[model samples]
Target chain A: MISLQDLTFSYRKGHLVLNNLQLHFEPGRIYGLLGKNGAGKSSLLYNICGLLYPQAGQCQVMGFNPAKRQPAFLRQVYLLPEAFHLPDVDIDQYVRLYAPFYPGFDSAAFDRHLDVFEVPRRQQLHALSHGQQKKVLISFALATTARILIMDEPTNGLDIPSKRQFRKVIAGCLREDQCMIISTHQVKDLDSLIDEVLILENGRIILKEPVTRITEKLSFRQVLSLEETEAPLYSEGALKGYAIVAVNRREEHSRLDMEMFFNAVMVEKEKILPLFTR
Target chain B: MQFSFSRFIHLCRLQLAANRKLYLLGMAALAGMLLAFMLFFLITDDELSYNTQQTIYMIGLVLSSGVFTTTIFKQYAEKSQRTQALMLPVSALEKMVLAVLLTLVVYPLVYTVICLSCLKVMNYIDIYWLGNPNALYWLNASYTPGLLIMYVYVQSFVLLGAIWFRKQTFVKSAVMICLIIIGIHAVHSFLGRKIIGSAQPANVEAVGQKLGATGISNFRYDGGMPYINTLLTASAKINGKWDTEYYMVELPRPGFAIMATVLILVPFFLWFITLLKLREQQL
Candidate 1:
C-alpha cells in the first residue's frame, strides 16, 4: 500500500510540481497511472519511491517512510525506471550481483521468467534490442517479488507482440499481495490489464477508481449525433458520428474503452469524478 | 546496530564487477611502478636515491587517488549504472559502505598484493632492494593507517560530490577547487594583515622559545607579530618542519589520531545520510 498526505514538492524553491497532493494505492490490483505529458506523473512516482523528498507533507509506502530507506522498506519495493540502459553484464551474473539485496528474491522464478521472455541468460544486456532489454527488466522486476512494484512507461519501446507478451507475463506473475502501479501514456496497451485507474492532471489526482466500477458508472458508445440521448455524461465528435460516454444503466456492463475513458477524464474531470464518488 | 560484513562484501563484489578491467589495469600500474622502484633501488643499493623517484611516487599517489575516487563515485552514480543501482533494494548505508570499501580497502588491498607479489618474484630472481626483504616492509611509515583513513575520508567526500552533483561531478570538482582556493587566499590575506599589524615583539620571542625560530618561520611569520590574534590562523601556521621547536612541541599522539579518524568519517556519514534522503523512486 502507498499513501501521500498533502504532499507538495518542487525541484527548486517556490516552484511546486506537486501541490497539496493526496493519493493512495492498495494491494490486490494493477493500477494504471494516466496523465498528460507534463502532469507531474513521473514526479509523483519519484515522490512515492522516495527518490524526491516533498517540500512539505508526507509520503509513505507500506507503512515505511521512503525517505528513511530502511533495508526492510527497500526490500519490499522495486522501481523499474524508464531509462532502460543496464550495465553491460550478462543476465545470469547480473542476477547474482543484484538478487541478494531483495529479501524475497526468487532466483528460480527469475530464471523461469527469463525463459518466459526468451531473454538469453548468456548475452550482455547492452547487446539486446530495445524491446528485448525492456523484457529483461520486466522479467527481473517480476522475479524480485517485491510487495510494491512501480513501473514507469513499462510498454514504451515494446513491439506489438512484445507488448502482449508483457501483459501476459505480468498477469501470470501478479500476486494478490503486490500492488503494481504503472505510469504510461499508452493506455491501449493496458486495456483489460489494469484493474484500477488513477488519472492525474494539474498536480492532482482528478480521478481514481476500479475499472469495473468506472465501466458501470460510465458507458462508451458510438452515436450518430451530438443530440442528447438520456443526457450522456460525455460526448466527443468522431469520424462517422459522435462518440459518447453516458452513465450505464443496463443490466449488462460493457468493456471500457481505456483511451476514450482517459480522454473523457482529462476533458471532463470534475463531472466524471463526482459521479463515481457518489 | 551495524551493517553486516557479508552484505558489504556482496556489494563490493558487484562494484568490482562494474569495472573489473579498470581495477585490474590499476593494479598492474601500481605493480609496474613498484617493480620500477625495486629495479632502481637494486641498481643503486640506496633507499633514498638522488633521482626523482619519490616525486614520481608522489605523483602516482595523487593520480591513483584521483582514479580511485572517481571510480568510487562512478560505480555508485555512473550514468550507465546509477539507474540500476538506485533500483536495488538496499539501504543507502549499504551502497555507501560498499563504495568506501571498494575505494579504500578492496582496491588498496589488490594493489598491495600485486606489488608484494612482484617484489617477491624479483627477490627470487636475486633482484631485490630495501635489502631486508621483509615483505611486511610495505606497511612502513608511508603506508600508515592514518593516511589510508584520511584518503578514504576524502574519497568519500568526493563520492558525496558525485551524488550531490550527479552528472555534474567534474563541475562540482572545479567549483570545490575554486572555493577552496578563494577561501585559502581570503584567510591568508586576513591573517597576513592581522599578524603584521598587531603582533607583539614579546609574542614572537615566546613563540621562538617554545617552538624555535625555524618552526616559527614555517608558521610563515611575515614580520611583526600582531597584538590582536585569531586562534584559527595561529593554529594553521603551527607546523613543525621549518618550525623545529613546534615540531618537538606537536608530536603525534594516538589519542589525537583516534579523534581525527572520527572527524574524517563525518563527511562520509553525511553523504550516506544524503543517499538515504534521495533514493530512486518506484517507477
Candidate 2:
C-alpha cells in the first residue's frame, strides 16, 4: 500500500511538478497511471520509490517513509524505471547477485516469466535487444515479489507481441498481497490488465476509479451518427463512427474503452469527472 | 536499519559480480603500467636513492588510488545507474562502507601487493641480470608515514568529488582538493603567524643567547598537518671527513592542539559528508 498527503514536489524551487497531491493505493490491484508528458507521472513514481524526496508533505509506502529508504522498505518496493541500465553480465549472474536482496525472489517464477518473454536465459543482458532487456528486467521486477511493484511505461520499446506477453506475465505474477502501479502512455496495451485507472493532469491525480465502477457509471460505444442518441459527455470521430463516452443511465452494458475514457477526461474535465465523483 | 553486516556483504558480492570484468581488466592495466614504470626507472636511473624510489612508489600509489576512487561511484553518475544503485536493498551506510572498503582498504592493499611485486622483480633484474652499479631495493626503502597518511587524506576529497560530481569526476576532484589545500594552507599560515609569530626560529646564539630560551625550530604546517619539529645537529668524523647530524627536540602542545584536532578530525567528517551525499543523491 502507498499513501501521499500534501505531497508537493519540484525539480526547481519555483516550479511545481506535483503539487499538494493526495493519493492512496492498496494491495491486490494493478493501477494504471495515465498522464500527459511532463504531467509528473515519472516524478510521482520516483517519489514513491524514494529516488526523489518530496519538497513538502509525506509519502508513506507500506507504513514506511520511502525517503528514509530503510532496507526493509526498499526490499518491499521495486521500481522498473522508464530507462534502466542492466549490468554487463549474464541473466543468471545478475539473478545470482541481486535475487538474494529480495527474500521472496522466486527463481522458478523468474525463469517462467523469462520463458514467456522469450528472452534467452544465458545471453549477456547487453546482448539482448532493447525490448528483450526490458522484458528481462520486467520479469526480474515481478520475481522480486516486492509488496509494491511499480512499472513506468512498461510497454515501451516492446513489439506488439512482446507487449501482449508483457500483459500476460503481469496478469499471472501479481499476488494478492502485492500492489502494482504501472504508469504508461499506451493505455490499450494495459487496458485489459489494469484493475484501476489513475488519470493524472495538472500535477494532480484528477481521476482514481476502478474499471468496474467506471463501466458501471459510463458507456463506451461507437455509432455511425450521434443525432439519435442521448446527450454524450464526450465524443471523438473515428473512421467509420463517432466513439462516444456517455453516462450509463439506462443500465446498458458496455466495455470500458480506456482510450475513449482518457480522452473524455481530458476534453470534458468539467462534465465527466462529476459522474465519477457521485 | 542503518548497518547490517550481512546485507553489506551481499552488496559487496553484488558489486563484485556486476563489475568482475571491469575489476579484472583494471587490475591487469594497473599491473602493466606499474611494471612498465618500474622497468623504465630501473633502466634510466642507475643512481636512484631510496628517497627517489619511494617517492615514485608513493606518487604512483596516490595517483592510481585517486583514479580508482574517482570511478568507484560511477553508479551514481547517470540516471539509470543511480536508480539501480539507490533502489538496492542496502542501507546508505552499507554502501558507504563498501566504498570506503574498496577505496581505502581493498584497492590500496591489492595495489600495494602489485607495486611491491613489481618492485621486487625489478630489483632482482637490476642486481642480478643488469648488474647495475646502484640498485634500489624495496626492503631498503623506508616510507614516511606522513606520505602514506597524506595519500588517504588527499583521496578523501576525491572520494567526495566522485560522489558529488556527475562527470569529469577525477579532474574536478583533483581541482577541488587543490583549492581546499591551498585555502587551508593559507589559513594555517596566517593563524600560525598570528599566534606563534612570523619569525623563523634560529639557534640560541643567533637570536641572542639565553640558556633556556626556546621556541620550535623546523616547524611544519602543510595544509592541515601541523607539526613542531625539533632539530639536533652533530658532527662526526668518518674517514677524516666530518658528517653533520641534527636531532629533533620536543615543544609545548597547547597552541597546536586546536589545529591538530580539526586537522585530524576532517577525514572522518569528509567521509560523513560523503555518506550524506550518497543518502541524498536523487535521480
Candidate 3:
C-alpha cells in the first residue's frame, strides 16, 4: 500500500533529517511506527501522505506518487496530523461543506461515528475540548473510508477511556483493504492494535516484522529476581521485578510487551533481528 | 481528470463562510453608499454625469481592493492559523486557486453588481450597458481587472512573506531587501561584477527588429518607473522611429491568466512541498 525508496530529506541545506531510508507496508494490517521524540516518525508519515517531498528518492501510496497529489490519489489517503485546527463552524456545517470534496465521503458513517462518540454535532468545533476535537477529527478520518490512513501521535491528548475507545473503534472500523500506519511513542496504547512493527532509528528502518513472528521467535517475562543465572536476550530491572525478553524455549505463547520489545530492538537490534529471519 | 465546476463552487463557498464577517461588512457599506447616492439624485433631480459615476467607481474599486487584500492576509494565511491548515487532503494548488477565485473573481464580481445596481437605482445606468458588466466606461478604460490581477500578484507575494517570516513580516521583508542590496554589492566588491552587472537600456530598434516590428516595441509598457526612464534615456535620433504597436494598452486576459497561474499556483505547490519537507524534519 506504501513504499519509500532511498528517501533522504532535510529541512534546509546541510542538515539531513531522514537519511537514505527504505520502507514498505502492505494492506490488511496495522503497522506501528516506533521511535523517540523527534525521531522523524511524523516526517515519515507526512512523506507517505505526500505532505512532504524528499530531497532524494521517492514515496508512493497505493500505486500513485504522493507528491503528484492527484485527486484520485488523495481520495484514497488520509493524514491525521499532530496539530489540527478545524473550522469554527458547527460540525454539521463543516461536514456539509467538506463532504462533497471527497468522492468516497460517507455521510451516514460519519453521523454514526459522531453518534457513537456522542459528539454534539450542532456545537461549533472551537467550543469543544481538546479530546472532543480529536474525536471529531478521528471520526471524520474514519468516515472518509480511505485506503491508507497515516496518523501521527493519535493517542496523545486522549484520556484512558477515550484512548481505549480510539483503539477499539479503529480496530473494528478497519477493512481488509485498508492500511493504517500509526506513529506514536506511546506503545502500550497500540499493544493489541498493531500487527507489525516498523522501528526507525538513526534515520533508517532497523527492524520490520509481524507481532506473531516476534512472539514466536522471542519471549517476554517478569522474573522475580534479576540474579537469574542464564543471561536473557534483553533485560531491564523494574520496580516489581526484572523485565526480560529472551529467545522463547517453551511451547507457551508469551504475552508480548510492545514497549519492552521496542527497547530490545533498539538495544540488541542485531542479535534480535536474526532470530526473526525466515 | 475532469475539473468539477460544482466542487470549485463548493470550495468557493467554504472560503466565503470563512470570511463572512468581511463579506457582511462590505455588503453593508455598499448598501449604505447606494442609498446615499439615490437620495442625492432624488433631491437634486440632475443626472449624475458619466464622469462622476466613473470617479465613484474608481474610488470604490481602490478602497475595496485594499479591503480585500488585507482580509486575504488575515483569513487565508495568517501565521497563527497556518499550522492548522497544513494537514487537509486538499493540495496547495487547489487551495491557492480557491483563494484567488474568492479574492479576485468572486469579490470583484460581487462589487461590480453592487455598483451597477447603485447606478440603476440612480437612473444613471443604461440598460444596454447593464448586459455587459465588463463594458462599464471606467472599468473597461481603466483596466480594473488588470489592476486587480496585479493586486493578486502582490497578495500572493505577501502570502509568501507571511510564510517566510512568522513574526513582523513587514520588518523582516525590509531587512531582507537591505541585505540583498548590501550582499550584492559585497559580492561584487569581492568577485567583480560578472553576476548582476549594472542595469542597461534595451535598444528599441533591435528589440523591434527581433520581434519582427511587432515585438517589444509593439507593447505599451505602462509600468511608470524604469520604463519611463528607459523612454527618457532613448537617443533623440531613434525617437518615433520605433514601432509602437506593442506599446498600446489592450485587453488584459492573457496577461492576467499567465500571471495569476504563476503567482498563485507556483507558490502554492512550493508551500505544499515545504510542508512535506517540514513534516519529515518534524518527525
Candidate 4:
C-alpha cells in the first residue's frame, strides 16, 4: 500500500508538476495511471520509488517513508523508468550480481519470463534490441517479486507480441500482496488488464476509481447521433458513430473502454468528478 | 542506517560485473606502459640505475592513480546510468565504500604488483639477455610511504571532482587542483612578505642560522625571502661527494606533523562529502 498526503513536487521553482496531491494505492489491484504530457505521472512514480524527493508533503509506501530510501523500503519497491541502462554483462551474470539485493527474487520465475518473452538468456544486455532489452527489464522486475512495482511507459519500446507477452507475464506473476502501477499514454495496451484507473490533470488527480465502479456509474456506447441520448457527458466521433459516455440509469453492465473512459474523464472532468469524489 | 557485509559484497560484485572489463584492460595497459618505459631506459641510457626506475614508477603510479580515482564514479555523470546506479537496492554508504575500495585500495595494490612484476622481468632481461646485473631492482623501500601519501591526497580531490562535476571529470579536477595550488602559494607568499618584511638585515649568517634552526633548509638571505617554493634544489653529501638533489620544502618538526595530518585527513573528508552528495543525488 502507498499513501501520498499533499504531495507537492516541481523540477523548477514556480513550475509545479504535482501540487497539493493526495493519493492512496492499495494491494491486489493493477493501477493504470493516465495523464497528458508533463502531467506529473512519471514524477509521481519516481517519488513513490524514491528516485526523486518531493518539494513538500509526504509519501509513504508500504508503511515506510519512500524519501528515506531505506534498505527495507527499497527492497520492497521497484521502479522501471521510461529509459534505463543495463550493464554489458550477459543475463546470468547480471542476475547473479543484482538479484541478491531482493530477498524474494525468483530465479525460476525469471527463467520462465525470459522463455515467455523469447529473449536469449546468454546475450549481453547491450547487444539486445531495444524491445528485447525492455522485455528483459520487465521480466527482471516481475521476477524480483517486490511488493510495489511502479513502471513508467512499460510498453513504450515493446513490439505488439512482446507487449501481449508482457501483460501475460505481469498478470500471472502478481501476488495478492503485490501492487502494480503502470503509467502510460497508451491505454489500449493495458486494456482489460488494469483493475483501477487513475487520471491526472493540471497537477491534480481528477479521477481515481475501479473499472467496475466507473462502469456502474456511467454507460459507454456508440450512438448514431448526440440527440439519441438525453444528456451525454462526453462523446467522440467514431467510425460507426459517436462514442458516448452517459449516466447508467438502467443498471446495465458493459465492459470499460479505457481509451474512451480516459477521454471522457479528461473532457467532462467536472461532470465525472461528482460520481467518484467520495 | 544499517550496514550489512553481505550487502556490501553484493554491491562490490555488481560494480565488478559492470566494469571488470574496463578495469582489466586498464591494468593491462598500465603494465605495457611500465614495460615500455623500463625498456626505453635500458636501451637509451648508457647506465640504468635505480633512481631512473624510481622516477618511471612514480610517474606511472601517479598518472594511473589519478585517472582511476577520477573515473571511479563516472556512472553518475549521465542521467540514464545515474538512474540505474541510484535505483540499486543498496545503501548509499555501501556504494560509496565499494568505490573507495576499488579506487583507493584495490587499484593501487594491483598497480604496485604489476609494476613490480614488470620490473622483475626487465631486470631478468637485463641480467640474462644483456649481461647486466644492476639494470633494475624490484623493490625500493624509500618511495612506498611517500608515494601512498601523495596518492591519497591527489585521489581525494579527484574523487571529489568526479562527484562535483558532471562532465569532464579528469580535466576539471586537474584544473581545479592547479588553481588550488596556485592560490595556496599566492596566499603563503603574501603572508610571508607581510610577516618577514621586504628588507633583510645586514647579518646574513644570523638569518640563515635562524631559518636553519627552524628546519627551513633552502633559503637565501640576500634581500628578502620573496617566495618559499615547495620544490627546492639542495646540495648534500651523498657517498662523501657533494651532490645536488631535488627536495620538497622542509618544515619544522611540528609543521611537518601538521602537514602529515592534513594529508591523512583530506581523503577521509572528501570521501565523506562524496557520500553525502551521493545520498542526496537526484536524477
Candidate 5:
C-alpha cells in the first residue's frame, strides 16, 4: 500500500512539477497511471521509490517514509525507471549477484518469465538489443517479488508481440498482497490488463476509478452524430461515426474504450468531473 | 538501519562480481610499470641504494593509493549507475564499509605484494646474472609506517572527493588539497607572527636559544624551524673511533602527536561525511 498526503515536489525552486497532491493506492490491483507529457508521472513514481523526496508533505509506502530509504522499506518496493543501465554480465550472473538482496526472490518465476519473453539466458546484457535488455529487466523486476512494483513506461521499446507477453506476465505475476502502478503514455498496451485507472492532469489526479465502475457509470458507443445521443458528456469523431461517452441511464452494457475514455476525460473534464466525483 | 551480515557479504560479493576485471587489470598495469621502473634503474644507475628503492616504492604507493581511492565511489557519479547502486536492498553503511575495504585495505595490500614480488625477481637477476653482491632488499625500509599513515590521510580526501565532485575527481581533489595546504600554511604563519612579536630573532637557532633560556627543554631548532624536541641522541667518528657527540637533529613530540592524531582521525571523518552525502544523494 502507498499513501501521499499533500505531497509537493519541484525540480526548480519556483516551478512545481508535482503540486500538493493527495493519493492512495491499495494492494491486489494494477493501477494504470495515465497522464500527458510532463504530467509528473515519473516524478510521482520516484517519490514513492524514495529516489526523489517530496518538498512539502508525507509520502509513505508500507508504513515507511520512502525518503529514509531504509533497507526494510527498500526490500519491499522496486522501481523500474524509464531508463536504466544493466551491467555487462550474463543474465544468470546478474541474477546471482542481485537476487540475494531481496529475500523473496523467486528464481523459478524468473526463469519462467524469461522463457515467456523468449530471451536468451547466456548472452551478456549489454550485448542484447535495447528491447531484449528491457525484457530481461522486466523479467527480473517481476522476479523480485516486491510488494509494490512501480514501473515507469514498462511497455516502451517492446514489440507488438512482446507487449502482449509483457501484459500476460504481469497479470500472471500479481499476488493477493502485491500492487503494481504502471505509468505509460501508451494506453493500448495495458487496455484490459489494468483494473484501475488513475488520470493525472495539472499536477494532481483528476480521476481515479475502477474499470468496472467507469463502465457502469458511463456508456461508450459509436453514434451517427451528436444529435443521435442525448446529453453526451464527451464525443470524438471516428472513421465510421463518432465515439461518444454518455451517462448510462438504461443499464446498457458496453466495453470500456481507454483511448476514447482518456480523450473524453482530457477534453470534457468539466462535464466528466461531476459524474466521477458524485 | 537494518544491516544483516549475510546481506553485507552479498553486497561485497556483488561488487566484486561487477568490478573484479577492472581491479585486476589495474593491478596488472601497476605491476608492469613497477617492473619497468625497477629494470631501468637496475641497468642504468651505478649504485641502486636502499634509499633510492624506498623513495620509488613510496612514490608508487602514494600514486596508486590516490588513484584507487578517487575511484572508489565512481559509480555514484553517473545517474544510471547511482540508481542501480542506491536501489540495492543494502544499507548505506554496508556499502561504505565495502568501499573502504576495497580502496584502503585490499588495494594497498595487493599493490605491495606485486611490488615486492617484482623486487624479488630483480634481486634474483642482480645476484645471478649481473654478479652484483649487494642486492636490494624490498622489506628493509623505515618508510612503511609514515607512508601508510600518510596514505590514509591523503586517500581520505580523495575518497571524499570521489563522492563530492561527480566529474574529474582526481584533479579536483588534488587542487582542493593544494588550496587547503596553502590556506593552513598561511594561517599558521600569520598566527606565529602575531604570537611571537616581529622583533624576535630571524634564525631558528636564536629562537631555540631563547626557548631554552625560558626552561623549554623540549624545544629544538632544525632547518630554520623550531620544534619540540622529544628525543635526541648524537654520535661522531673521531680518529677512526665513534664517540658521543653533541645534538645534530631534533624531533618534536607535540607536533608528531598532533600529526599522528590527524592522520588517525581524518580518514574516519571523511568516510562519515561521504556516508552522509550518499544518504542525501538524488538521481
Candidate 6:
C-alpha cells in the first residue's frame, strides 16, 4: 500500500510541482495514472520511489517512509521510470546481478515475461534497440515481483503488437498482494487493464476512482445529435455521431471510454464529478 | 538501514559487473600509457632518470585518483541512471564503501604495481638493448607513508567533489579542492604570522650557543611540526661527503599528533560525510 498526505514537492525552490497532494493506493488493484505534460506524474512516481524528497508532508509506502529509502522498503517497491539505462550485460548477467536484491524475485516468472515480450535472451542489453531494451527492463521489473510496482510511461516506444504483449504480460504477472500504478499519456493502452484511474492536475490528484464505480455513475454513449439528451456532461466528435459522458441515472451499461472520461474530467469537472460523488 | 556483508559483496559484484568493460579498458589504457612513457624516456634520454620515473608515478597516481573517483558514482549524475542507482536495494553506506574500496584501495594498489612493473621493464631495455648502465628501475616514492597518507586524504575530498558536482566532475572537483587547500593554507599562514612572528630569532639564539654569529646566516628556518619534540635538523654535504647536521630540539611530547589527526582522522570523517551526502541524493 502507498499513502501520500499533504505532500508538497518542487524541483525548484518556490515553484511547486505537487502541492498539498494526497492519495492512497491499496493492494489488489492496478492504478492508471493519467496526466498532461508537467502535471507531476513522473514527479509523484519519483517521490514514491525515493528519487525525490517531498518538500513538506509525508509519504508512506508499505509502512515505511519512502524518503528514508531503507533496503526493506526499496526491495518491495520497484519504479520502472519512463526512461532507463541498462548496463552492458546480457539478460542472464543482468538477472544474476540485480535479481538477488529482491528476496521474492521469480526467475521463472521473469523468463515467462521475456518470452511473452519475445525479447532475445542472449543479446547484450545496450546493443539491443530501444524498444527491445525497454522490453528487457519491463520483463525484469515484472520478475522482481515487488509488492508496489510504479511504472511511468510503460507503453511508450512500443510497437502495436508489443503493446498488446505488454498488457498481457502485466495482467498475467500481477499478484493479489501487489499494487501496480502505471502512468502514461496513452489512455487507450490502459483502457481495460487498469482497475483504478488517478488524474493528476494542477499539482493535485483531483480524481482517484475505480473504473467500475466510474462506469456505475456515468454512461459513455454515442449520440447522433447534441439534443438527444437534455444536457450531457461531456461530448466529443465521433465518425457519424458524438461520444458523450452523461450521468447514468437509468443505470445503462457501457464500457468506459478512458480517453473521453479523462477529457471530460479535464473540461467538465464541475458538472461531471458531482455525479460520481452521488 | 541494513548492513549485510553478503549483500555488500553482491553490491560490489553488481558494480563491477555493471562497469567491467570500462574498468578493464581503463586499466589497459593506464598500462599502455605507462609503457609509452617509459619507451619515450628510453629513446630520448641517455637513461631513464629515477626522477622522471618518480614524476610519472606521482603525477599518474594523482591524476588517476581524480579520474577514478570522479567516475565511481557517475550513475548518480543523470536522472535515468540516478533513478536506477537510488532504487537499488543496497544502503547508501554500502554504495559509499564500494566507492571507497575502488578509489582508495584497489586503484592505488593496481596503479602502483603497473608503475613499478613499467619501471622494471624500462630498466631492462636500457641495460639489455641500449647498453646503458645504472638505469634506475624501482620507484619507492609512492610507497612512502607521507605520500600514501596524502593520496588518500586528497582522494577523499575529490570523491566528495564528484558527488557534489555532477557535471564536469573532475574539473570542478579539482578546482574546489585547490580552493580548499588554498583557504586552509591562508588560514594556517595567518595564524602563524599572528602567533609565531619570526622563527629566525628563536633559532638565532640556538645557533649562537652552538656556532659563531655567522653560522646563524647559513640556517634557513621554516615552520616546525606541532609535536612535543621537534627536529631542527639540516643536511649539508661537508668535506666532499653527504653528512647529517643534526640539531634535534625537544620542546614537548605532542609529536605529530596534529598531522596525524588531520591526515588519519579527517579522511575517514570526510568519507562519512560522503555517505551522508549520498544518502541525501535525489534525482
Clashes of each: 13, 6, 12, 0, 1, 3
Q: Which stretches in model 5 have alpha-carbon errors above 4 Å?
A: A223-227, A230-237, B39-49, B122-139, B198-263
Two-chain DockQ for model 3 = 0.16
Candidate 6 lDDT over A1-278, as tens digits, reads 88899999998998999999888899989999998999999999989888889999999998998888999999999988888999999989999999999999999989989898999898898889889888888888888989999889988998999999998998787899999999999989878899999999979988889999999999999999999795898899999789999989999999999999999999998987777663
Can you list the residue pairs that collide in candidate 4? Answer: none
- Please give each candidate's TM-score: 0.77, 0.90, 0.69, 0.87, 0.87, 0.93
DockQ of 4: 0.69
Give the higher-TM-score candidate: 3 or 5.
5
After best superposition, candidate 1 residue A141: deviation in angstroms?
A: 1.1
lDDT of 4 by residue, A39-157 (tens): 98988888898878999998988888877778888889888888888888999988898899999999999999999999988899889998999888898899999999988999998
Instruction: Return the lDDT, model 2, position A30.
Output: 95
- Predicted candidate 5 versus true structure: per-residue lDDT over A1-278, tens digit per residue: 89999999999999888889989999999999999999889888889989889999999899999988898888899888778888778899999998998889999999999999999898988899899999988898889999999888998999999999998999898998999999998888897889999998877999999999999999999998788679788888889788899999898999888888998899998888788876
RMSD of each candidate relative to the true structure = 6.6, 4.7, 10.1, 5.0, 5.5, 3.6
Please provide, for model 2 over A185-227, each residue's C-alpha lDDT reduced to its tens digit, 9 standing for 90 to 100. Answer: 9999999988999999879889999999999999998888998
Residue B42, candidate 2: alpha-carbon lDDT: 65
Better of 2 and 5 by TM-score: 2
When sorted by DockQ, best at the front, the candidate numbers are 6, 2, 4, 5, 1, 3
Residue B15 accuracy (lDDT) in model 3? 73
Q: Which is superior by lDDT, 3 or 6?
A: 6
Between candidates 2 and 6, the one scoring higher on lDDT is: 6
| Stronger candidate by lDDT (3 vs 4) | 4
i-RMSD of model 2 (Å, 1 decimal): 0.8
Write one digit per residue (lDDT tens) for candidate 1, span A256-276.
889889888777777787887
TM-score of chain B of each: 0.58, 0.81, 0.46, 0.77, 0.76, 0.83
Q: Lowest summed lDDT over 10 consecutive residues: which window, candidate 3 chain B?
A: B224-233
**What's model 4's overall lDDT?**
0.81
CAPRI verdict (incorrect, acceptable, medium, high) for model 3 = incorrect
